[model samples]
Target: MAQGDMRDRPRHAGAGDRQMTALDPRAMRLANAETVLRALYGADALSQAAIATATGLSRRTVELILVDLEAEGWVRVRSTEPHASGRGRPARQYAFRSEVGVVLGIDIAHDRSTVAAADLRGRTLHTAVVPMPGEPERAERLAGTRRAVAEALRAVGVRPGQVGSVSVATPGNVNDKGAVDVELSMHGWTGVRLAEEFAPDFAVPVHVENNAKLAVLAELWEGATPGADHLLWLMLEGQYNGMGIVMDGVPYRGVDGAAGEIFWAKGLGLDALTASPLIGLGRLEPEERRAEATAILERAERGDPAALSEVDSFADVLARGLSALSWVFAPRYVVLGGWLAWALGDLLATRVAARMARNAPPFVAVRRSTLGPDAVVRGAIRAALDRYEWTAARPLAPERRPSPVDGG
Candidate 1:
C-alpha cells in the first residue's frame, strides 16, 4: 500500500493521546503489539521509524513488537529499500503476512447474498453471489445462506476450520446480545440468532451486524471516506432504507441498535413513501419492477424528460428520508451505497445532497460510495479479519473459543 492508501484509514481524533485502552500489564503489551500490527496492515509496508511515528511508540518498542510479530508469522520483512533522501543506509520494510490465514465476509441481502474471501491486507481474492429464495420460513432462508457461504468459501479454497473468522451483514438491528430484533422487510428474517446458527455450522467465530453498519465499516476501512471522523451512510435499496453512523472511527450503535433507522421516524412519514410503487414493487419475485426502474434510469440517462421526471420523484423520496436523518445526527460526511447507488449514479448523490443541505449544517459533505456493490461483503471481510487478530491475541474470550463439540 502506498501512503495515499493509508489516507483511506479513518483519522485518529487525538494522535498523542493514549488511544489504546488500559489493561493488565500482559494485556497492555498484547494490545500494543496489536496496534503495531494494525499500523503495518494499514501501511502495507512501513519502516520501523514510520511505524513508531504513526503509532506514537518509540522505535525500540516498535522493533520489539515487530520481532514478536515476525516470530508469530503475523508479519514479514519485505525489503530494505533506500529512500531518496540519500542520507543513510537503506531501511528495512515490514508488512502483515498476506497468506497467514483467510477471512470470509458474507453479505445477506433480501434478494441475493454475496460472499467474499480476503486476506488481512484487505485484498479481495474471490467473490460469489447467489440468488436468495423467496422463502418465508426463517429456518429455510438461513439454511440457504449457510449453503451459499459454504459453497463460496469452498470455491475459494477455504476450509471451514481454516477460516479465521466470519462476519455477516443483514438488514436488521443487531443488539449487544447478538440478537437480531429489527424487522427485515425481506421475505424471511426476524429475531434470528445469526451468530449461534452460523457459528456451529461454520465452526468459526461469527460476528453479525446490520448491513448499513458494515457499509460504513467498508468506507472507513478502504473507501472514499477512509479518514473521515464522523460519517453517515445511507443505503438505498428496494427492500429497505438502511442507514449507519460512525463517530471517531467506531460505529455508534444507538440504544437497541437502531441508531440510523430514520426511515421509521413518525413525522417524516417516509415508511409509506419507501414502500410506494416506485421502490417496494421492485422486490417482487419476477423482479419486473426492478426491470422497469432500470429502464427508466436508462431513458433518463439518454435525456428523456418523462423518465427524468420519474427519477427525480424517486430521488426526492430518498432526499426526504435523508433529511430526517441529517437533522438527528448531522454527520460530517454521508455516503450513499446499495443497488440504487449503481443504478442512479451521480443523480442519486446530487439530489440527496441537495435535500439534505436544505436541513443540514453547512459543513456536511455528501458523496457516493466508491466501493460499489462489494461494500458490504468487503466490510464483513474486514470485520472478520479484525476479529481474527483479536482472537489470536486472546483466544480465551468466550466469543473466540470454539463450541464444546468443536473441541474447545
Candidate 2:
C-alpha cells in the first residue's frame, strides 16, 4: 500500500494499549463487541455458538454483545429453527440488521447522472438515471442529481432520515475532505463543496471522490478482480480518459488526489498517444455518441475495415499508456472500463494486449470491465459503505462511541 493509504487505515491496538485495555473491563467489552460486529457485518445469519467460535469469545460474552447490538438496532434475530436432532429448544439465528439504514451513491457526469441506494452490505436496492439535455451549470447539474437521488430513495421506500452516508463520484481531483480541488468538465464546478451542498438534504456524512478512482474501488470490491491488491482501471470514455490505480489494496491518491489523472496526456507531449478516436465520438450528443460508438464497435467485430482501423488506433494509444503504467506500478491486472471499452469488448483488450506484449510486464493481465456505464455509481455506493464502516460504524476504541444519528 502507498504510505498515505497505509497511514489512513484503522490501526490495531498495540501491545501496550492491549495491556491497558485488558485491565479496563469496559474497554475489553468494547473491543469484544467490535470484533463480534465485524464478523457479522458481511456474513449470513449466524447462531450465537457460531459467532462465539468465529470470534474466539466465550458463549456468554457473545450473547451479551449480540443483545446489546440488537438493542442498538445493529442486529436482529433472523429465524428460529429446530436442531438437527429435533431435541430441546430451537436455535435462533442472529443477523446484522442491514435494513437499518441505506447509503447513497451519486455519479455525476457531463452527459448524464446516476443515483443509487444500497444497504449496509453494499447491495444496491434502487437506482435512477437522469439524462442532462444540454450543458448544465453546477446548480442545474446538482439539482438534477438531487432529484434522482430522491426518486431512487422513494422507489425503495427509504426516507432521507434513513440514509446513513452519501458518496459522490465526479470528474475532478478530490481532496481528503471530499472537496473538489479541480474540475473542468462542468461549469462552476471547480470549487464546489459537494459534501456541504448535499449535507442539508441527508444530514449525514458525505464522501466525494474522483470518478476514476471510485471506478477502481468498484472493480476491487465487487467486479472482476475481487482480491487483487494491485490493479489499474483505465477509463476510455468520451473526453474522460483517465486512470485509477490501486497498490496493495489501497488507492494511490497523490498528495493532491491527482494520482491517476491520465486524461491530461496532451499536456505531457503525448498527443499521438491520446484517446482521440474515442473523444471524437464524444463530440456528438450523449445518446447519439453511445449509439454511434456501439455501432462502430459492432461493425469492427464484423471485420469492417474503417471501423477496425479506428479501434486499432484507439487501442494503440491505450496500449502505450498501459505499458507505461504497468512498468511503473507493476499492477497484477489492468482493467479497461468506460463506454468505449464496454462497447469494444475483447477486441480492444486483445489489440492492447498484443501491443503491450513486447513493452509491458509479462505477468500483467489486461481485462475488459463488465460493469460498463454503471461502474462509477456502483463505485460510489461501495465508497459510501466503506467510509461509513471505517468512520461511523466501527468505534476506534472504547473512548469513542458510534453515532446514534448516523446509525453507526
Candidate 3:
C-alpha cells in the first residue's frame, strides 16, 4: 500500500464492534473478513503483508480473507513488476473488484429523463437521455424514465441482475419511503413510489431523492464546492425553482422532506419574479420557450440592454432568496445549478452574488456549478455507491451475483 493509503488505515473498534467480537467463532471470521475487505476497498492495492499490518490481523488471517473474497468475486490480485531482490518474487497485491457489478442512477426531470450506469467505484460507464412529452401523464413520464434506464444499462452491456443498487433523483419532495410527497413539476407525481416502480425491473435496492437535494450532494461529491460542510443549492430548472439545504455535510431534508420549498409560497415574490422574459417564458409554447430563452441569454451575453435588464431582474429574485436562506442556514457557499446555471453561466452567479452582498454574510460566497446538467444523475450515482458500500460487510447472496451480458 502507498503511504497515503496507510495514513488512515487503522480501524477503531466501537461498541458494536466490541459486542460483535464476543459472538461465536463464525462471527469472528466474518468480522475479520469485513475488516480486510474494507481496507482493500479504501486503497488502490495492498499486499498481504500491508493488509495484515494495516488491519492489525495476522498475515495468515489476511491471506485467508483475501482468498475468500477473491473466490466471491469481490477482490482481484493486481499485476505488479517483479521485485528487485534476487532472492524471491514480489508479494502479491490485491485490489477491490469494483468492476464486478454495476449501479444505476436515474434523473427524472419534467422535460427529460437521464440515466447513468456506474461501477462500484462511481465511474459512469454509460448514460442515456430521453426527452419527455410536454405535459406528460404520470404513467407516460415513468415509462420514459424506465426506458431511459433500460437504454443506459443495455449500452453498458449489463443486466438488471448485475446492478447492486439503483437511485433516482426526481423533482419533488421525497419522503422516507422513497415516494414523492409533493409534486412540484409534473402532474399526478405525488404519492408515486419510485422505488416500487423500478424494483421489479432491477431486483435490487432502489432509492429515490429530491433532485435539488441530489444536486447539492453532487456539488459536494464532484462540484467545485470543496470542504463546504454548510452549503445551499439554488435550483433554477424549467418550470421549477427550489432550494437544497446542506448542513454539516449532510442534506437537510426538513420535516416531511419540505425544507427548501419556499418558492411555492406567494409571500416570497418568487412566482412574480418569474414573469421577466429572461426567466419566465411560460406563455410561449414549450418547444419555443427553450430556444427563445437561449436567444435571450445570448443577447444578454452580447450586452443587449433589454436582455441585460431581464437578467438583472432575474438575479434580483435569486439574490433575495439566497439572502433569506443565508440568514437561516448561514452556509459557507451557495451553488447556482440546474438548467438556468448552465444557460446563464457565471454572468448570473456574479450578479446574484453582488446583489446579495449587502444582506448575506461576507463569508457566504456564491458560484456557478461546474457539474453541468447531469449533476442530479451523478449525485444519484454517488447515493447508490454509498448504499453499495454498506453491503460490503455482508456476504453476497447467491441471488445477488452479477452476470454481465458482455463485460463490466
Candidate 4:
C-alpha cells in the first residue's frame, strides 16, 4: 500500500475544506449522502455508526440521510449483524440500490469514439463504437458524434430524458472555462465550448475532459492503481499524445490547461516526429493502420530486424516524451494507454521504464493500463454519475420573482 505522504500535500486547503467549499448547503448534504451510499455500495453492508465514522458525519445525520435515500429507492437496509466484540446490540446495516437510472460515457478518440452506459453501481450495461470520418469538417463530425451517442443510449433502452448526465473525453487540454484546446492531435478543436455545444440538446450537465486526464480518473476509480495519489496517465497513440496528473488523489489541471502536452518537448525536438513518418503513416484509416501495425508486431516477434528497429524507434520517441513529463510532474506511477499501446506490449513499457530510470529520478514506476482503450469512456461514465448525484440531490435555484401584476 502506498501511504499518502504528508509532504506532498497540495498548497490548497485539505479535502474537508475543499469538499465543503465546492457544494452549497443542499448540495453538501447530497454529496455527503452520496459518499455514504458509495461506501456502503462498495462494502456491501455497513452499520450506520460505521458509515458515520468512515464519512465523518454524525450517526444521527447518517440515519437521516439513509432514510431519505431509501425513500428515493437509492438505498436499502440489510440484515443486522452482531458485533464481533459483542460489546453492544446487533446493528442495522445499509447498502445502495443497484437499479437507479443510468449514466453515459463518451470517449472521442482520434479515429473512433466509444459510448457506454452504466447503472449507479458502475456496471457497464451497453457499449457502441462509431468510426471517425477521415478529416471531416468539425460541424459534421460533432453532429455525427451526437447522433451516435443518442443511438447507443437508445440501444441500451436508455431514453434521452432518462439519462442523468453525459461525460465526454476528448484528446487535448480542457480548461476550467470549459474550452478545450488541442493543437497537436485534435486539430480544429481549439477553443471549443463543450458545455454550450452539448448541454441544450441533452438538457443535462455535460463534463468534457482531456482523454488522458479521464484515463487517470478511471484508474483511480476502478483500475489497478485504485486510491493512488500522485499518478500520471500517458496516452500513446499516433502523433497525438496526452497526459493526466493526479496529486494526492485529486486531478491537477495546471493554469491555462496545457499541463501535459509534452509532445512539444524542446530538448528532444519531437515536433519532427509528429511530421511525416509517424503522422503520415497514422493518417491511414484506423483499420488499415491497425492491420499494418499488428503485422509489424508479429514480424518483430518473429525476430525481423527491420520491424524491431521500427518498434524501437517508436519506443524511443515515447520514452523521451515520458522523461520530459517525469522531470516536471514527478508522479509516483505512470500509466500507458491508447490504441498503439497494444502494439507496444510489455516490451515497450519495460523499455520506457528503463529509459526513465536511467534519465529521470528513482521515485517513479511505469505501468501499462489494465483498462486499455475503454478507460476514457469508463472515466466519462464516472464523471456523469457524479453529476447525476449532484443534480438529483439539489435542484437549481428558482428564478427571481417579479412584483404582483396589480399591486405596486
lDDT of 3 by residue, 182-224 (tens): 8856888988998888888866779899888887877777688
Tens-place lDDT per residue, model 1, 36-130, is 86677566689999999988999998988888878777777887888789878899999866566667788887767777776555566666677
lDDT of candidate 4 over 105-130, digit per residue (tens): 88877676778877655567777777
The number of clashing residue pairs in each candidate reads 1, 0, 0, 0
Give the winner by TM-score: 3 or 4. Answer: 3
Instruction: Give the candidate order by descending lDDT.
Output: 3, 2, 1, 4
User: TM-scores across all candidates?
Assistant: 0.79, 0.84, 0.86, 0.78
| Cα lDDT, all candidates | 0.71, 0.75, 0.77, 0.69
lDDT of 3 at 301: 90
Clashing pairs in 2: none
Candidate RMSDs in order: 6.4, 6.1, 4.2, 9.0
lDDT of 2 at 48: 90
Worst 10 residues of 4 by lDDT: 399-408
lDDT measured at residue 57 in model 2 versus the true structure, 0 to 100: 90
